[model samples]
Target: MRLVLLSLLLVLAGCQAPASNQASQPKVPTFYNHWELFAIDAVKVPRLKPAQRLDVDRNYMVSGMAGCNRVFGQGKFEAGVLTFENLSTTMKICPAELDRYEQSITEVLSNDPKVTMYRGDLVLRANHRVLQYRLVKETSSQ
Candidate 1:
């Protein structure tokens, strides 16, 4: 009886793959909270009002911005590399600093994803765990 029970347990365990063995999202190199500023780009700066579900689509990982209209830009996330083409924001009137904050958001869209002051860097997972993006803007001088 002991031998039969041991064999059955072993078979059950084998049938169920180990947690570590389960296929999971790809891992990135590392994460950083803040990124250095660089020249802003004219072409890539996304429109003021982003009317899209930025996070749902595996297309990109994004978050930030308040209401739909008069939206204040927050942050964005991307896997591998980031792009300014995709941004979701509400259109809400904001103060000067918030407006400028939105501009900065556009600038960093290429440098690195919006970072948490305390969190440092955001973790980009295929699912809910927000993704990271790297923005590369083209200077207007060109």
Candidate 2:
């Protein structure tokens, strides 16, 4: 009787599910398909509101408004890094500050930057400068 009881207890213990390690691991956040620039290097661009945005399409093409001009480029995102290449922007005249802002954005994009998504915002860091963007939710148009 004693032996049978011991065997039954062992079998029950073996049948119990093991603790899962997956629950302890952190999950990576997914990048948004569209983002609008909210700030650059912790300072907001006052006049260029909603004029700078980033759209990552299905083809990995990056297109958006940089200040007053339309900018397009090939972009790749992998392993939390983003690289933009073959960038070309429309030649449009704008204010000196806007032109400077556009130039800064172009330079940063050209350099491969580390991408981070935090608190519902997209951040790109390169050469000690940070570009912050907010996720743009798409609405259905009838």
Candidate 3:
């Protein structure tokens, strides 16, 4: 009788679920997916002539176009935290105002930002800014 009870208790323990928080943690989206900037700080993003966008790959590489310049760097996403490193951009000159916007984007990307999804939009929050991006559907050519 004692052996049976011990075995039952061990099986019960093994069957128990994990902690609530652990079970409830949001699943990280596939970071390798492509996305396009949609808005910043709740403001509609200005249309860029060259189309600013971001693309991340499984190899920890990030590439994007920032208004007027091509940008690429190393980036990592873990546990909902996104971080960029060693980002470099082309020196091409854009409009003064657009250049400022580009700088802001680079600054945010280089920081340790918290990433979340809202209403099918990928939102990145850092400091006092919130950037929202929409998933970019893959083209058949790619």
Ranking by TM-score: 3, 2, 1
RMSD of each: 13.3, 5.1, 3.6
Q: Candidate 3 on 1-142: residue-level lDDT in tens?
A: 9999999999877776566657897787665667788888888887776777888777658788876888889877788888766778888988986786687677677677788888877787887788788888653433
> What C-alpha lDDT do the candidate models reach, one value each?
0.39, 0.75, 0.77
lDDT of 1 by residue, 30-67 (tens): 33222222212322223334321122223234444422
Candidate 1 regions off by >4 Å?
1-6, 23-85, 88-95, 110-142
Cα RMSD (Å) between model 3 and the true structure? Answer: 3.6
Model 2 TM-score relative to the real fold: 0.71
Stretches of candidate 2 above 4 Å error? 1-28, 47-50, 139-142
- What are the models' TM-scores? 0.31, 0.71, 0.75
Choose the strongest candidate by lDDT.
3
lDDT of 2 by residue, 29-96 (tens): 45547778888898875646546888766556888888778888887777767786577889989788
Deviation of model 3 at 16, angstroms? 2.4
Give the range where candidate 2 is weakest over 10 consecutive residues by summed lDDT: 17-26
Candidate with better TM-score, 1 vs 2: 2
